[model samples]
Target: MNKQAPQNSVRLPERMRHLAVDSRGYPVIATINRSPEKVDFGSISERRKLALGTFDWCAVCGMPFADELRWQMVFEEGALPAALSGEAPVHEVCALYAAQVCPFLFSPRSRLSDEGRKGEVRESVVRFVGFESTSAVIPHASELQPGIHTLAFEQRGHADEFSYSSPDELGERFADALAREKPLPVSDAEAVLVRLFNRLDDEGEGDVVTGAALAAGAVFAKDIFKVQGLGAFQGKSYPTAAALLLKGTEEQILKFSHDSQDEAFSAIGPWVLERAGRFPLALQRWRTRGNSMVKNLGPSSPQGPGRSVAKNAPCPCGSKRKARRCHPAGVQATP
Candidate 1:
């Protein structure tokens, strides 16, 4: 009888083991070293060069950084698939922080009564505390670093000293950061940028008018705040992107949302539209200014409004014909 071969696992790359498979069955070839193929995510160029789903990919948050960052699973208590047993999966990073703060988010809180939920003051209070505590601990958090808190929270495990921050805390931090940064209203921002570009242009700065800037300006005009583009018309002038920041019920901004209760929609959507409107306005202004500037130059050779042709007269340039025949296309002969 012939001896049968084992079919199950296969060896992968440098020192890393892998199971090989075929139509019949997968078999292990042998354990091998993990591949020496090193990848870097820091460089955007490198990230672009990478193929999709090449490295550790997260379904929820997308790719996790190779170096220090780790992925953690976060799921609502009841959200776990029936097939899954204990807890919903999450990245390790999220798991660590979730472990520290807002433990309720990980496993569902089943105890709260309907009346308690209706009140739900405790949850809000806890979140507020979390935000204040985090801000107190982390200067950067209090400062409201843009995406830094998220980034830091993601990479906290890598560092020696790091604190857990709740999502609310993160939001507050971001808001504070925005406050500190004091981003000009979207309309004002574009104007500032445009002004900067002009100053740079006057002083022989680098290419200020760029495809990206134009695209960005167009997006600002259409989406966020209505700031006119570098060259735009006045008929198109509209409000600043700040209109999107209007914090009120849809009832308040009647012109904004289709529904009165749609608060989120009312807040940001109009701002985007405002920005979009501005792009055309800016372009129109540019054209108008350009025309005026061009007109400032001296006039060209003067000429009559084609008054030379006389009624009943032969054409001056002789086509050797009567006035009627030669200059039929020209002015009628004088009576």
Candidate 2:
């Protein structure tokens, strides 16, 4: 389900993702192959503006990320799928046509009411695909950060998608989706997510994004470092890697309903607290500049647990055993 910002929620901020072609932060105007209609100046609209969906895969075609053949730009070299929306990579044709039709490209705005959604406001992501020599965009938002205004898919090759619909045909599909509607079939994972989302609503915590973020925090604090290949991040950007892991795990966790929302929240709550406790200043800075409504969602304040958990204290995960016995080996209480 799409995340919705309430009618009175603070307005989201925005920034333009100007292409910095070289080391000098100068703007470069790159071009995608334009459609005949676009080239002939035959299209005009006074209707509301449109933008791409919030997705990791191609906004036009629903393809999952499996190989480099499918180009999705990511900020950090080792970012997770969940964090790819900041760059929402797509097919070259899709990118070119989308840029032509999207109103966001010419002028970026901080908040737009989702075309047909009554009360939800979302920031736009202006993506530029096909630029080569990939690297992280500087001063960009991390996975946990909100108000991301750009997803740069600079330089890329294409997947062996031997078939594709005509641009006119695909254009209709994109327009429909951009207008708060979908013609695509719902997948099992998404269905399960909706079921769990209903559970969240019943608990008066209806926002899917908030639930997902808190759940992600749980995964980040405990299990991320344990991933077999995560050590690679220690040399470059641990925060980016941690953000990627957290969002990726959140996607996996949200695929089904839990026995209860309390079960759901408790499952992830302790770890969220632990992360805040461990890095108050870093988290605070993320909160200050990174975009989100979840800033005030879970904890009233991100204070440490205030004291060490006794070796005899019950585990934060609510397992019926002492912390030392239940948690992974050498895990210490959050500072």
Best by TM-score: 2
Candidate 1 residue runs with Cα over 4 Å from true position: 1-40, 43-92, 95-239, 247-249, 259-335
What digit string (tens of lDDT, one per residue) describes model 2 on residues 21-62? 222221111211112122211111100000111112233332
Model 2, C-alpha of 152: deviation from truth (Å): 6.7
Model 2 error, position 48 (Å)? 19
Local accuracy of candidate 1 as per-residue lDDT tens digits, 185-217: 324333333332222122121122222222222
Superposed by TM-score, candidate 1 places the C-alpha of residue 20 at a distance from the truth, in angstroms, of 26
- Maximum-lDDT candidate: 2
Q: Which pairs, if any, clash in model 2?
A: 86-151, 130-155, 131-154, 131-155, 132-155, 146-291, 147-291
Whole-model lDDT values for every prediction: 0.25, 0.30
